[model samples]
Target: MIQRISHFFTAIVHRILPDPLIFAILLTVVTFVLAFGLTPTQPAELVVLWGAGFWNLLAFSMQMALILVTGHALASSPLVKRMLVALASSARTPGQAVMLVAFVGAVACAINWGFGLVLGAMLSREVARRVKGTDYRLLVACAYMGFLTWHGGLSGSVPLVAATRGNPMEKTIGLIPVSHTIFTGYNAFITFALIVLLPILARLMMPRPEDVVSVDPRLLEEPPTVERTLSPDATFAERLEESRALAILVALVCAAYLIIRTIEKGFVLDIDTVNLMFLAAGMILHKTPMGYARAIGTAAKGASGIMIQFPFYAGIQALMDHSGLAGVITRWFVDVANVHTFPLLAFLSSAVINFAVPSGGGHWVVQGPFVMPAAKALGADLGKSAMAIAYGEAWTNMAQPFWALPALAIAGLGVRDIMGYCVTALLFSGLVFVAGMYLF
Candidate 1:
């Protein structure tokens, strides 16, 4: 039954869903029409909102681009490739490969979402290479499914932001500690449940032998690196570009900076830090300046979607923010919610909002002010309320293709190829989230 359901969704999504870029474009049009209809803002003003917010995510887009390129380069380095291959070798069967990728991706996401996004996809490709007859699309989907645990984990943007001092809602809610939010008994139970159940879910969703779509073996084969030959009389600049010494020196400098930052800040893991670390690792492992450059060139090809599509989503978020549409949606849920039902309602509302504002931090910014005040007035647990919003933002990501771009780019698949499995994940995990909201 589960397999049938999975197949059903996969087929439906494959047939109906367009390319992710087209999906984003359609979403932009839909949000524009909705904002125009729902808000008091005039159509002219709405156009301004979209235009004004279009470039709002420039810095964030650059960071995302860097993460994708750097993480890919790091993964493609000889040392990391060998390590991933060794790990993939342990999965003797297709089912084991699915479970292994799912488990590793979940754990990685728990530690750092950016890292997990790239690691899971890269590892899935490697696993497909090592384990014949593995369903490649399903493998990538399972990898993306691991992202569901990110909000309950250490780098969870919503909880981490709420815990920080001077946050916008700090006056109303005060600084809720991580213990009450991320590390609480209820959260622990939810996280552990997902870590266990998701793998089993992936295993159950595995396609039959004849139906499985394995990766093309040629795609797994690494392209041979072309070295520019230099005579003994090579120019000084040519020598410098090809020098192992230059790459090692830069790597050492980055390493020292990372060590110093860790000592000073006690293990801060932001996107910038992750990008730098990956850059350092890629340089060190690639063994020469030219080799690292070549790897980066290879990786940059995968980041085009990220570079192009993020601004549209940023504009969508801006439209929601400026046009008062997001607030209206939140307040409607609050108006209908009782103390007992607020968390679940907030969770569901957040799931809707996440399709527009996919960033966890961005979601909290818009929803926290309204949701936190409502929680306080109703005497609900603020911690759980915050987490409910967090979970919702993470939950709907199964259907939201924005966050999946990096993973899909790395895996050489389209949104339609994997979203069917992800839709199934969305439904199954939604039940778990509802249970967590009510039971604990």
Candidate 2:
């Protein structure tokens, strides 16, 4: 039955899902229409909003691109590749391969989303290379299913924000600690459930042997080493480029900085730090500045989609936030919700709003003000309410391809290749999110 449902959704997505760029464009149109109709914002203002907000994510776009480049470089390093290969070799069958990829992706993303995205893609590629007869598309989708656990994990933005001082909701709900938000009994159930069950779900979704879409072994070949023998009398400039000493020195410096940062802020991670860590590690593992640089050059081609498509989603986020449409949507859910249902409804509303604002930090900003005050008034669990919003954002990402760009770029697959399976995951995981919010 699970396989049948997976097959059904896969077929539907293949038939209906357009290119991710087109999907983003279509989402923009839908957001425009919804915001215009639902809010008092006029057409002219909406136009300015869209155009003005289009460039808002330029910095974020750069970070994402770096994640692709740096992460690819790191994964391509001999040490990392060997590690991934060892893990991939553990799975003897396609089912085990799919399950392993899902579990690794979940654990990685739960630790840090940026790290998770790149590792998941790289691991999937390694798994595909070693696991013959595995469905390549299903492997990628299973990797992405691991993303659902992120918002409940240590690095989850909504929970982190709720726990922080002077957040927008700080005055209303005060500071809800991580113990209440991320470390709670209910959250544990949800995160553990997804971590444990999603792999099983992915295993179930595996296509039959004959039906499997196997990738070419040549395509999965490890990235070539950048190191090459230099002439005895190589020029100083050329030597500097390949200088292993320089790479080691730089990596050590970065290591010290990161250690200091960890000491100051515990384990808090953001995009820039993650990128730097990957960059430093890649440089060290590759054994030279030039080697890591060459690896980055090869990996950069994958970032083209991220560079072109993020602006469209940024515009949608602006339209959703500035137009008051996101707030209005949340209000609708809050209006219909009582104390018992507030968290569930908040999760649902965040799930809807996530289509426009597909970002973790962005979701908290858009949904926090409304959900926090309402939870306070209704005597609801503020920590759970915040988590509900986070869960919603993470849950719907399986349907929203906004976050999938990194994984797809690295895996060398199109959105359609993995989306059908992701849609299946989206449907199946909805039960976990709902149960987490209301039951525990």
Candidate 3:
């Protein structure tokens, strides 16, 4: 009877939400209610809930603009096709192929996660075709391995640090001394190393083909137009180029963010002022309601989990803050830990949360308050602590189901296949996590 109830709830979750975002949100709310009461003793404190709700909307709206544009730009490229082909040609074994796909997925995600999602989805399909006798599952897994690890890469984490700029905590948590340049370069190097090494590792753990069924050969066949045609009327390339309208919209939004950031530093707008300004900016900049509406819709589709979960986390922190649980938790962890353990915990927490709550921004929203205070109290490498959070969020991204949906859809594979490949990717990721713990 209990098992039946559990299955029933799971079925409902899959039906209504059909994604991790809602799940994250529901879990957060449940945890918050369990941890705190239905109401705070001071009704005025409810303002925190309002503040968190706005933060969720604003942050997610911004993320949608970024992801949509990046996805369109990266997906339309012929280079993505070439990269997929090159990967297919290079790998000898099923495992090797999976690693290559994952590496590429990570690269795509690092460069731009929005792009990573679309690119991985499209490329995984191509790989499925090439591995004539292999199950599409391996390719799907490869895509997610890359999809999941992306937060640790440059594009996602650096922006967060940059957002904080020269504030006290930002300065103290000097994870990337050179800021964006160093962060991207370091992440790129890590991405490259993973690309090279992951395939070799996959080759060792690859399961026999007898256990997995092969896909249809028709799926592998390249279209005649792919090889043959150029048209004067309107080339395929032109159609592809036109699709970049949304991408341009997104780029402009990011540019606006940078511009606002400059103004913010020059004038020192308070958080509330900044929020209002951005809200106004979004309203003005989007112009047509449909464009902004589309961006929001897309974001809502992708980031509902982030939207719901972040506030719950905020509430959790608020409970801790108001009730003194956070202080107690911090003191306990600090008292028990040595310096070596702190970094390890930072990495572990990051990995665990990344899997459960995959968005970097959302994770940071909750983690920043808790981790920041802990870092100050514990005397851990503050910069490294920040990076650890960033890194942990990124490392587990390689396996997170939150990111697997797109890849699975594109590749015509199941989650099981992707999870299988992730098993191998996680082993190496663990090693990297340990190294980061010690090195930083």
lDDT of each: 0.90, 0.90, 0.52
* lDDT (10s digit) by residue, model 2, range 1-440: 88888888888888899999999999999999998999999999999999999999999999999999999988888888899999999999898999999999999988998899889899999999887889999998988889999999878998888878878878767899999899998999898899999999998898877778888666676667687778999999989988999999999999999899899888668788899899899989989888888999999989989988999988999999999999999999998999988888999999999988999889878888888899999999888888889999999999989899999988888898898889888888999988877777
> Which residue pairs collide in model 1, if any?
none
41-153 per-residue lDDT for model 3 (tens digits) = 34345445434543444454444434433342233235545666676677665665666676777677766565566566666666666655544655665566665445555
**Count of steric clashes across candidates, in order:** 0, 0, 7
**On a 0 to 1 TM-score scale, where does candidate 3 land against the true structure?**
0.61
Regions more than 4 Å wrong, model 2? none
Runs in model 1 deviating more than 4 A are 226-230
RMSD of each: 1.3, 1.2, 9.5
Judge candidate 3 against the unseen true structure and give its global Cα lDDT, from 0 to 1. Answer: 0.52
TM-score of each: 0.97, 0.97, 0.61
